[model samples]
Target: MSDTIQPPFSILFVDDDQMSRHHFARAVSDDYRVHLAQGADEAMVLLKELGPEIAVLVTDFRMPGRDGGHLLREVAQAYPQIVRILVTAYADKDMLLQTFNTGDLFRIIEKPLRMDSVREVLKQAVARYAERETRQQRLLAMDETLAFLAHELNTPLAAISLFARSVENDVAQEYDPQRQREIGAAATSMLNNAQYCLTLISSFWATVHKSGGQQPASGSGVREVRAARLLATLLDSYPFAGLQREWIDVDVHGDFVVHAMPNCVALVLSSLMSNALRALDGCPAPSLCIEVISEPEPEIRLRDNGPGIAPEVKARLLLDPVTTHAGQGGHGMGMIFCNRIMQSFGGGLRIESTLGEGTTVTMRFPGSRGRIRDADGEQASVTRTV
Candidate 1:
């Protein structure tokens, strides 16, 4: 519910049925600020007017004149940041999968729209939007800080080095004759190195800060990454100590593709690895499984045999990240950032854990392949043998 008394962000619900739209709004208005659009045409007008305020777009699959699929595709082209969700009673996997991949659907809700399920999905959607916004702000701040390092930091350093070099020369010369000669030579060498560094900084300032250009996001151009190849590279280069490498088992039913920045994928894997390793620290015979599946859209799953997370802790962490191991220097930002990254990829991360049993984290990527899973429970995997 955004942990706020007032509704946090706007959710646009588009449906041709008046009863359905009204019921959806009435049920969700307590948790979210709901906007009603009777069809794609009206939805477009509202989006144009209140686009910045809206965080999610939940439209029924069957709407008059332009339909939800058309609306979603148009929105994907224009307002890509808004999370897209589809509500459908259409049991056809082929149609759903096609719309899923094409329209960049963040999630699909089955018809008979249970209010409980709707609320939960809306909460997650809101969280995803918030996390994306937070990440953008951080990126902007990081860019500015980098620019400061390149442009604003050099002048003071130049002055300091100039004066310091002169002072060092004078001190070495005036102090004692023999030692002073040795010291002066050393000081001169240091100054030469400092001058070289300054030259490099000046070059960087000129090249990067010209006209105050903004730096694009890291891996902004990345998409359609091969899961098998990427996993191979990550496992090869990932730092594993002693038997840690052997402890991991990769079950490749078949290679599949994922769409996201390569760096983001690496970052997600690294975080899961770190967390799993920490959880296994005091355990006996630890193991982790990396499952690469081709069906129901390409997916990479990581299952770890470690102390499973408590439900309460998991709940709190999902809502607001706080380190479980703060004493051990954990900042607790890994999973939420991973969640945001997965959302940014047009998929979502699902975590299932039992107290005594190990945890399974599934990373779902958006694509049309094999049989589609149920929107709620685990999907039947139709594996392609390599």
Candidate 2:
């Protein structure tokens, strides 16, 4: 049952007959919150006031002003969430057909209704209401999740744009060894960031399409990803400008490899890099270091020499949206999204920081070091470690 429908669910009984209305309310008052309305006008007033609370509507077919069919149709249009049923003493076949065709009628009870039959019909109506409410809530939740995902991708998209412009600028510069190297690095980084954005977009749309009753093509799942190479790619491609680019170091100690999706890994690293850069805004000797540990568990440690997280903020960092730099336009969904991604890969995210010191974000991939395979069923190795 949906939380919207509390115990002793509400029902609006609308009829012109005072005797019939009172009789029905008295019988069902023990099991439901019965709201008696003399006619369609009174029923409309009650519905306008307590529309969301009322789960079922039982109206007489032949009322004085507006007939039951008209009232049911009005209810269907105004408050479609409510389950509608018509009651009539004159069971005219033509009238019943017209009523069924026009209104959102759930069930029709004849005049002199049996208590047992009414109870069963009400049970079904409540069940139907619950199902519809649950579906509506799920749809609302999905919309919110999609909105959050779009918010999460904004930083990366902006970074990609900046990196692309940098690549163009670096390429147009005078030909020199240093300039050439910088151009090459910038181009590579631009490509990696673009690919990361595409991957996130694809994953998001795939979920949306699946929810909309569309079947997505099956593809390879998690695979052996070289941690050292992945981190290097991320570091090179990250959109860091001016002195910010110089304030970063990469240290790879061992052959770190983990079975995971490359794009997911890229997104997690990108998010961490963005956070580190943002935190290092106004520091004197702002430096960020990424360390890879392969022995105990494949993990990447991102350490930044900047203002650390506050105690209250650190406690619910990944669980909720909390940002120390919200004044600089932070939505606070980056780390939370990263944490969720890590959890999807059978991994976890950990954060440690002191007030005056800095923050260290550890992305732990706890699994055995796996060998990557090529298309020809051959084991491939990444020999580069920085």
**Please, what is the whole-model Cα lDDT of each candidate in the order they appear?**
0.70, 0.73
TM-score of 1: 0.44
TM-score of each prediction: 0.44, 0.58
Which candidate ranks first by TM-score, i.e. highest?
2
Record all residue pairs in model 2 with backbone atoms less than 3 Å apart, i.e. clashing: 189-237
Candidate 1 yields a Cα-based lDDT of 0.70
Candidate 1, after superposition: displacement of residue 377 in Å? 4.5
| Residue 207 local lDDT, model 1 | 34
What is candidate 2's lDDT per residue for 1-63, written digit by digit as tens? 223334435999998889898889877776778899989999999988999889999999887
lDDT of 1 by residue, 147-252 (tens): 3333223433443465566666676454768766766555654454355345445544553464243333437563455787777876775655446788888889
The list of candidate 2 runs beyond 4 A from truth reads 1-9, 175-185, 188-192, 205-386
RMSD of each: 17.1, 13.5
Please, what's the RMSD in Å of model 1?
17.1
